[model samples]
Target: MAGRGDIGVRIGLSAVIFVLDGPGLSVLTTHAQEVAPGLPFGPFDPTRHRTFELALRAFVTAQTGFRLGFVEQLYTFGDAGRDTPRAAPAGDPARQVSVGYLALTRDALAPPSADARWRPVESFFPWEARRAGRLPLIDEFLAPRLRAWADAEPGERRRRRVEALFALEDDAGWNEAAVLDRYELLYEAGLVAEAARDRPEPPAADDAPLLGQPMESDHRRILATGLGRLRSKLRYRPVLFDLAPETFTLSQLQAAAEAVSGLRLHKQNFRRGVERTGLVAPLGRTTTGTGGRPAELFTARLGAPEDGHAPGLALPALR
Candidate 1:
């Protein structure tokens, strides 16, 4: 619904480049104008680029100085009732649609540029990391606040949504891949800093919980999309190998899986299942780096033995 002078559509590109290393799980982010960080982002130049993927790769490399590999389109985000405070309001009246891509790498590297660096995924979405079992943030802090937020509204659906998203009825029912759902719920309830940034008016209550670290613009939403996509992709695609070392011990592989999935996997079940799938083969050598008895080293065999089609691993959670 443009009156007369709307610039119409503006296309931008962003990357959610993730890596697993000593820091556990982390994503590459460039310094944003505000205190928060943002995904590598730039406008898509249709004149210079033939494809969206190429444009994404070009800017991500320019901003982070690290070329991307094993990337996939995540989702497109539109500007609607979102506050991009330091944004280019100059276009004064143009809608921006950012196409986000998920990039996975085996190692974390120092971005050749000073503006970009790797930040732990937990720093922004700490609640998503549940591999260690119960989180006090969920039980003691997040639940009560979210329950209050739901109750303040005039609908039973809100309460039901809270119960479903948080799995308050059954702790074991929590879905790790629903990162976007949970984050969107939090944003809707004004329990996060981004909520405050977006809303022009003051918060409904002074005590509204400001949970998790914030990101510039809607980059966090894009990140939640990437995280959720990665979690879900693990079930049917061998994308985890893109984020694994060239060679690693079975223990290391399990640890990487646990880090990404945010679930404490059952050791015996995980090992048996992985071995059964023929997704990995032992190197006939052992590594003492695990700080215990020698553990056998293994390499990822991305393709299945039968059809050469790679399938994702099954996570045997320690329920």
Candidate 2:
């Protein structure tokens, strides 16, 4: 292991926390006055902090005032020149290596700081969400542009990738877990701000499509990594309960799944899947505030599982 002095690499921690709200899955974000919103990010202090996760939890709480729960390390970002645009740490000129994390919560806390706020996840990746059905930006704009780029390429690999990731062909289906892949493709095509920032020259077209809102630094890329990890984890883990309330209705549970996956599920089918897994149990209570008949409330049975997997019916493949 390299000591702190061996390599001038400063470790940092960044988190992408998602909360379900009226609009759907929203992320906790922060920024200075008149600056682009970014994930809760801060440098990890080796002296005062014992572990990297502890240091991350402390800074995130101090900055956002939202306590993190069920945080898992997502990835480590260490590309040079990516952290240049942001405020550098005080010390020697060093490479900033950030350990990214993903956390989920049921409540959206008000940021005590004036600069912090909650922004909808779809705002950063407009093309990823499918709750609105067909997206004009994808069908009308992104498809044509990406198709053109794929055709210009010399090999079948690029075309195949575009088709699979973007769901360009009629048979090809969209994969929510491929969030990072999709983002990297957009960056390579010069559709995103990070691509332009990384390249020696600006994108060829002055009218290049600003794919989505950009973060201050490579925070957006880190966010994509978190998003992809969460989506993929839904398949094998019961981590989704971290985003659910202590007690919630079945419809509410379905809504949470839909919000995170960005897919509108068939109510009956979803309920059937949930039942088959025996993941939830009735609370012996019903609420009538749903604007219709009273619906039964259910709570996730965290202890019911014999093996380690919890039934997560959020993704389409689960159905």
Output the number of the TM-score-best candidate.
1
lDDT of each: 0.84, 0.81
Regions more than 4 Å wrong, model 1: 1-3, 84-91, 170-172, 205-209, 304-308
Best by lDDT: 1
Model 2: residues with Cα > 4 Å off, grouped in runs:
1-7, 85-87, 90-92, 206-209, 317-319
State the lDDT at 251 in candidate 1. 84
> What lDDT is reached at residue 198 by model 2?
74
- What is candidate 2's CA lDDT for residue 130? 85
What would the TM-scores of all predictions be? 0.93, 0.92
For 1-319, candidate 2 gives per-residue lDDT tens digits of 8676675777878889988878588889988777678888888777899998898888888887878887888889998776542445545578888889998887776778777799988889999888766567888888888888888889898788888898876666788889999999998888898788778997788465587888877888988998888878776677778888888888888888888887777888877878887878899999897778899989988785777656666454332
Residue 223, candidate 2: alpha-carbon lDDT: 87
Clashing pairs in 1: none
Question: Which 10 successive residues of model 1 have the least lDDT summed?
Answer: 82-91
lDDT of 1 by residue, 1-319 (tens): 7678656777888899999968388999889654688888888778999999998888888877899888899888886754442334553566778888998987586889998999989888988878888787888888888899899989799999888878776554878899999999998988888888888874677554577779988999999999999999988787878888989987888898998998899999988888877789788998898899998888987654577667788898875
Give the range of the ten consecutive residues with the poorest summed lDDT in model 2.
83-92
Error of 1 at 100 (Å): 0.7
